[model samples]
Target: MLGQGLVDVFFEDGLNWEADLLEDTRFVMVETTAYFEAYRHVLKGLQEIEEGQFPFEKYIIACENEVSPPKYLRNRRTVQFDLRPLVDENIVIREDEALRRQRRIVNYQFSAESRCAESVEILNLRSWPRPDQLHLDQSQYEALQTALTKEFVVTQGPPGTGKTYVGLKIVKALLHNASIWNSGHQSPMLIVCYTNHALDQFLEGIDSFFKGNIIRVGGRAGEDMAKHSLKVKKQALRKLQDMRQIAGVRFNCTKSMMEVKLEIERSGAQMEASEREILHEDMLRPFMDNCYDQMTCVELPQQQEIPSMMVEWLGLEQMLGETQVAVQQGREDDNLHDKQEDEIALSKRICNASVRLSTVTTKFVNPTIVLTTMPVHESSLLTSSNTTSVECHGQQ
Candidate 1:
């Protein structure tokens, strides 16, 4: 009777499978013998699933089975399937673990013998140093002290509470202690932020004090100021810089002064006055002589005589002739100015441009503090040393 029942269930499952297969538009009906032959051809149609394309349902199924499904099935449309059993099993396990953790936390909280409990009793919170430099409030000072002494501390407050400020002080104190403990060796510190904007703000706040000791990873906006960022590693940045230099040089050599002046004027509103001045002084003036030294340098096709009516309406006849005369006159005195000042300014810009790329490439050579959006605890920079990691998050 049991064997007959098992056979009935097997047939029922097969019929359900057949119905599902038929419902799916991707599958077609075939004779049982022909199906085996078609399978070989169908397998050839399978393509590898790209990363991040896996559906939520398929992910859950994969997790439940504890095995990866075939690549072809990964992209298939999800069917209505009951996941209650797997979900229930996970919920039960998690609930039990939560209960266990709750009991542990309760014991730790109430037990007089616990180290944290003992610290609260013996430590004089009032005696904690209030550094004049940090200008911490009473609440922030208490929070800082607790964080420094305890293994785990939760500091919570509403917005604009100086949480980040106090946390940075705590980090500074810990770094000083670590350096002493490690016999004058600078200790590595990893600072994690919730967002790239926060990371930039934090780095900017401490940049003067830390100077070359800080390295920032991720985000393109902070690249130039932070000295280190992941954007520096991209080949595109290097290429763009090279192209800019080439274009600057080419614009000086190829284009006439009148044409260049018109181009600059058209885009002048978008550029800073200082930047416009630099372009005129460093790039345009130096190359102006080369541009107009030879009349043959004009690359444009010869224009026919302009109509009197159009020239009067446009007022281009005088402007165009005057621009040519100015260029010729300016070429005479081009060699009279000092080239040293321009060279110095150009060198400074080049140095500033390469700083981020150089810093990111050589960051691991020394013990340094890193500011990043996520914790890079597994990085060799942290793992190789006795590093202290501090995570700070807030609305500010």
Candidate 2:
């Protein structure tokens, strides 16, 4: 059994005690009954303390048994007991409340009502030309309509049943009426595939109809027409550059004014108050204004412009420059193989950098649609309040 004083000390410093013991020791052991008794004693002590009737001093006496007294009560004023080792061994194992709550929430979120709402009838589609003209059979058209009206709907079919074709049509119809479903800005949607090849094919279909902003995260940007490709490292570097530019303008302006002030203070000359004020107003204000104007006048490139900017920024243009030089040199050299090899190497480097830059700069473009393989769908980049994802899979 645990003394009340020891229980009080445990309540006050249990976390620190556990951490220190765990650092030096792999595990601690205790008797089953004594361990439970200690927990009960601590809880009782806490309740008594809360009720304003705690008997702290009454339980401070050292026991005659081998179990030492608690560390806090070991001073000369009262009974001294070395109870640290005894109590440290008797830690109670309990379920983590927070983790339990999280699991419950996840279970609820994946339930039938949350994953797929009840199917509802949609209005006639004769007024909508593209959806009406889609080559879906009656069942495929009904599935398409159900997806549009329901908050969450899953489409399943065997191979070669026009599943993808009908899904694309539904996406197109949703994109056309996006304003009705969401706020009048962009409609954020995610398309997830089981493989990179499937992701590319899905993006191609989206590109054919949906002309809004699209960002592709993960894997290479295989198609030249892909809107945005995000390469991790180069994108991180670009973000760092953007941060520096934002801070450099204000920092340089402040530093310039400070230098002028220091110069004036160092010049061993007495000046009237009005003259010093005039010097500051004349020297500092215009320079600062000019700096601000210069910074603001520069317009940052739009998302569509990032590919071109990356070509220049990543030195792809320099590789092209070498290619031009190689072409001119080829005219003078009879060894055509050397010219061909040089051109191939340079072209490969340029192409690789182009794909990387396209991948890295994708997030900045605020794409309305994102297509990624299922393995990478859980990436933090894809989770946004405004976005919704659709997962497509096929039997292996």
Residue 81 of candidate 2: its Cα lDDT?
Answer: 17
Q: What lDDT does the true structure give each of the candidates?
A: 0.47, 0.50
Candidate closest to the true structure, highest lDDT? 2
Residue-wise lDDT of candidate 2 within 1-396, one digit each (tens)?
Answer: 256522322425445675555533443344464457536776776766643354332333332234333232233342211111111222112223364455421111122221112112133334222323344577787787566544445689899988887777666645543434433344477787766677778778777655456677666666653445666446877999999998999899999999999878855343554454223323333456665454435465574332233344444656756766898898668568878889999999876655211111122226554544344322233434554444333221
Q: How big is the positional error of residue 314 in model 1, measured in Å on the Cα after superposition?
A: 99
Candidate 1 wrong stretches, greater than 4 Å: 1-127, 130-134, 180-187, 230-396
Evaluated at residue 119, the lDDT of candidate 2 is 17
Where does candidate 2 stray beyond 4 Å? 1-139, 184-187, 220-227, 232-237, 240-247, 254-396
Q: Put down candidate 1 lDDT per residue, 1-396, tens digits, no spaces.
A: 766742222332246664554533453334474456435544444434455564444445444434343232244443122112111211111112354345431121222222222222113444333333235677886786566544435578998998777766665444323322233234456777767788887766555333234556655547445445645445557989999999998888777786888888866743665463222322333445654334323243367343232333345757756766899778755744446667888999876655211111222335775544443323322222444334332222
- Following a full C-alpha superposition, what root-mean-square deviation does model 1 have from the true structure? 38.3
Residue-level error in angstroms, candidate 1, position 69: 46
Number of colliding residue pairs in model 2: 8
